[model samples]
Target: MATHAVRVSGLVRSFGDRNVLDGLDLAIAPGEFVAILGRSGSGKSTLLKAVAGLDYDVTGDGDIAVAGEIAVAFQDSRLLPWLRVVDNVELGVRPGRGTAALAEVGLEGRERAWPSELSGGEQQRVALARCLVREPRVLLADEPFGALDALTRIRMHDLLRELCAKHQPAVLLVTHDVDEAIELADRVVVLHEGRIGLDVPAHDADRTHLLRALGIGVAA
Candidate 1:
């Protein structure tokens, strides 16, 4: 059996004239959280999609291997507007499991709430619940809290950390925010020009270093 929960070897992805991910390689251990950061159009999202198996149709030479189950959460909640909170979480899940998932995300009493009635943060919670209900062994998150207010984002971060600890799923979080990456990930990776430019433990990374890795000027 493979030792890593997720692995990408010799990965290459391109869009017409631009090679978004060129000969990229990444490995994620079980229950480890790795945050991705890069400048705009640096293939951050593209890399996540490739790992999540959404790039199956795209022509690529690399190989991806995953262990157990996979679940994804995007910046947009993507909940069906017509479905109630419980119904959305219950998608493809057994009856009554949605309530338990909601409770896990701190939305216990809001099972009957409509998607329209939820605030942005609450909606994201439901999205998280949807992913958690699957009992995934790998969780792919793409800027999952990017739309929330600062306080709400902090709260969601705490909740997410707790859930990941309990679930112990290897996590790949794609984000542009440096602080967010440092706050959540065991390791921080900066994708530059289609490859991993920097990979370091989060505890050893700082804002200025990360900014420089992304080719941004920092005032000294």
Candidate 2:
């Protein structure tokens, strides 16, 4: 059996009168790639944030053990205007460890360029690089490619898969696009009504069944 990287049981979170997450349970193995799909306001992002330790208000009797550090990449690039592309990517690194980090993201030569000078895709690449530089044990991504065009998004997906294969981090991605989840994740988990609606492996048959269960039509 694989060792669990993150475990959640009976997790609950409430905002005033509304319950965002109620009795949620999830278990993730090390180096697993899991994608979370949900409608708007289903607390998908909330769950990720809580697991990432960004939300302390959550109440749950769960065990989350990350052997390494955790890093997150938000929808926005979140780059500093004053810093160059490489510098932004290096922000997660120590003072002298920037070069190698930038190199890992394939931004070796563009380090000196400013964020504004790069395209949206390049900026997001820098953001991804920043997260990678941390060498995190778990990578939490919240719609990281939401802002890119179709071609760019596909390219980014490939890059992300390559990077994860190389680095071997447990990845949890929250995305609305079902195809994106199918293309990128080894498993797809659907969050509905503050609980896991479906959890299945990404094999051809299973993926088709899961998508149909989610009311998503498979490509004919």
- Residue 94, model 1: Cα distance from true site in angstroms: 1.2
TM-score on alpha carbons, each prediction = 0.97, 0.89
Question: Which candidate leads the pack in lDDT?
Answer: 1
Estimate the overall C-alpha local distance difference test score of candidate 1: 0.93
Alpha-carbon RMSD, each predicted model: 1.1, 2.5
Instruction: Give the range where candidate 1 is weakest over 10 consecutive residues by summed lDDT.
Output: 52-61
Best by TM-score: 1
Per-residue alpha-carbon lDDT of candidate 1 for residues 80-181, written as tens digits (9 for 90 to 100): 999999999999888889998999999989999999999999999999999988999899999999989999999999999999999889999999899999
Candidate 1 backbone clash number: 0
- Residue pairs of candidate 1 with colliding backbone atoms: none
